[model samples]
Target: MKTASRWAIHVVPGLNSFAYGRIAIQGDAAHAMTPYNGSGVNQAIEDAYVLGRMLTHPKTTMETVESALKAYDSVRRERAQGVQELSLQLGRLATFTEDLQLQPGADPIAVTAARLEAAGIWVGEGDLEDDVRKAEENFTKFIAKA
Candidate 1:
């Protein structure tokens, strides 16, 4: 190659919440992460799906929208933050920079492969419907308290 360029990966710090009152953030706006786990888009989609469900619930209305958004935050914040952390861990593993937390005499390669596989399993499996249901339930409870 005549020339080569290096690009830096940027990640957003994981936030405590994704919504405030009626305002909410999704995708990279909320939890930007490294590409090692390739889960940024997926987490965004999950955010959208859950928020959409909250906004469209029959019990949701102008007066209750803020609560709905808060409900979305309650449901998605933890999960998205978790994925964000996992993505960073995967990046460390991919770069061979992670400590790997090996035991005495453990094979580094095998440990890395096992860790990668565990991360893959987490990335690959989820229940979006359950998340949406939980958000809706939270919204209902919030409105009930009002």
Candidate 2:
């Protein structure tokens, strides 16, 4: 096996929104997280999915692109940031980092295992269709107000 001389993990602070005006950021650019839960790519894909839906809506136009981007931000920001935080917490738990506080009588190994299971469940427990629908609704409302 080839050994590399250096390794680094870079993460960005979570943001409240991923879009500003017509320019929207997705993937690692928006929410960078630790690799503990292996969710970075998944979250990026989700961002793309929602943004794609918003931008492709029949009613979307140059005049309303900003609203589409805002709708994308509204639907994706909270969920992506949540995954970012969960990924960070999983990293802490996996490494038994001091960031996690064990309750009295709590078994460290068991706790980590439980958290891992929950993360797996949570990662798989959302409806992409529902998310797209919500983004569409938000885009429509925003366009109406413009």
Candidate 3:
């Protein structure tokens, strides 16, 4: 086996805030993470899609843009933060640590594999359609009361 010379690892903590106003943040601007599970770009794309749907819906208007943005925040913030946290967890599992090395009866390789599989399941399974529908419905209801 070839010996590795050097390895570097970095993990970013999950961010809970991703919304402000019409000036919405997405991508790395919203949640930055190590390139472990490829969640940054995927979440950004999902953000764009959801924002687009919210903005273009017939119920949304200039007067209601703030309401739409609030809807986006309601729908996307928790889910995006979840993905960010999972990415951080995967990053921690990938990097070698003294604790991992010293743990009795622990198989680092197997643990890593299991963590990765769980992350894959989480990142792969999402109901974007349902999220968008809820955003639209909530926004409509929010504005109806205004």
Candidate 4:
């Protein structure tokens, strides 16, 4: 085997997960992982929240329910992974004690400030309910192909 220069491993803590749509899968049965930033548990909890909402909705069809679940995946995945990536990026700076990688809209601050500012913009976009609803409507009408 070729020798690799670096290796990293993650230890996933136990947990439960659930989703809605004509069906529900719960607990570690749905998702299982330990994030370096301790976000895994919170994300799993969000699943529990939306899953319950989906279950209680009368308009919930296998299709609609599935759609909601897909929405949840899109939203939650972005939120959780975004934070996780930020934390990992931060760890890199802390470990290296160097300047941040400059990219789009990047400024000349130290790595930590740049990272936090970028993270703020990533997270500061608000009115999530309205945003998702607008996005879904747009997808259904304009963007989606039959």
Candidate 5:
């Protein structure tokens, strides 16, 4: 990152099919990448949450599963790629290179971490399942009122 001016890299998903197994890996396990945009886990959580919803739905079918997976692939592929690209960008700008001397003020790692946390990726040590359940309960209450 310090050696160059403009940085970008596309963090690709590693064997995404790991997500569709009987006993599957969740979050970063199935698809891990840099914390460039901070949405990896948040996006993963979104991925897991959505998949859980789909699998539990009574209408789920091979066709439906395939279709949903396609949609998820479409969305997640870009997300992972984008994060990799951004991390590359930060690496270029922040890291110290042989040719250049850095002032040592900006913290790219923390910045990236903060961004990811905001996206609800890691959630500052918070409980993701609890949040999801609360959301469901809130929706149920709203529906009841309506």
Candidate 6:
């Protein structure tokens, strides 16, 4: 008897914004992902890096920590969510039989492989320096206002 494996990716909107009232969640606590593209660990690391930098900066203080967390949240939420969506899309591409069966193509597997390759760009290509700069800029503005 052949059994099918159950694989799923559940996404929650705005999961990276796990800070509130001096409390913040990081790593897997902030966002969860399936091990589709092996991005879960990397994302968690990124989250920790962002949160750690904000909370440990010399300019950050107890009074202004909230602003830093908010800036981290603002920067991380969209990027993390984008990764989640891409992971889901990659899963769909890997198991694209349902849609392909309906409309038989000359090479369904090839098409799926191409789609997967295209989607992998997001997973593999990201500018961490640029992201950090933007987050710092946002945090600076937040601090200035506070």
Whichever of 4 and 6 has more TM-score, that candidate is: 6
Ranking by lDDT: 2, 1, 3, 6, 4, 5
What is the C-alpha lDDT profile of model 1 across 1-146, one tens digit per residue? 77768778788897878888779999999998888788899899988989888888888889999899999998899888889899889888888999877889999989999999998898778788888888888888989997
The models' CA-based lDDT, in order, is 0.88, 0.88, 0.77, 0.50, 0.49, 0.75
Q: In model 2, where is the ten-residue run with the lowest total lDDT?
A: 92-101
What's model 2's TM-score?
A: 0.90
Candidate 4, residue 63: the lDDT equals 50
lDDT of 2 by residue, 1-146 (tens): 49898779898797867888879999999998888889999999999989888889998899999999999998898998889888888878877883447899998788778878998899889998999998888988999999
Predicted structure 5, TM vs. truth? 0.41
lDDT of 5: 0.49
Q: For residues 1-146, write the lDDT of model 3, one tens digit per residue.
A: 49988777553455555556556777777766667678788888889999899888887788888788878878888887788777767767777542345368878787778768978998899789999999888898878876
lDDT winner, 4 or 6: 6
Q: Which candidate is the best by TM-score?
A: 1
TM-score of each: 0.93, 0.90, 0.78, 0.49, 0.41, 0.80
Pairs clashing within candidate 3 = none
- Candidate 3 root-mean-square deviation in Å: 5.0
Off by over 4 Å in 6: 1-16, 97-106
TM-score of model 1 vs. true structure: 0.93
Which regions in candidate 1 have their CA more than 4 angstroms from the true location?
1-4
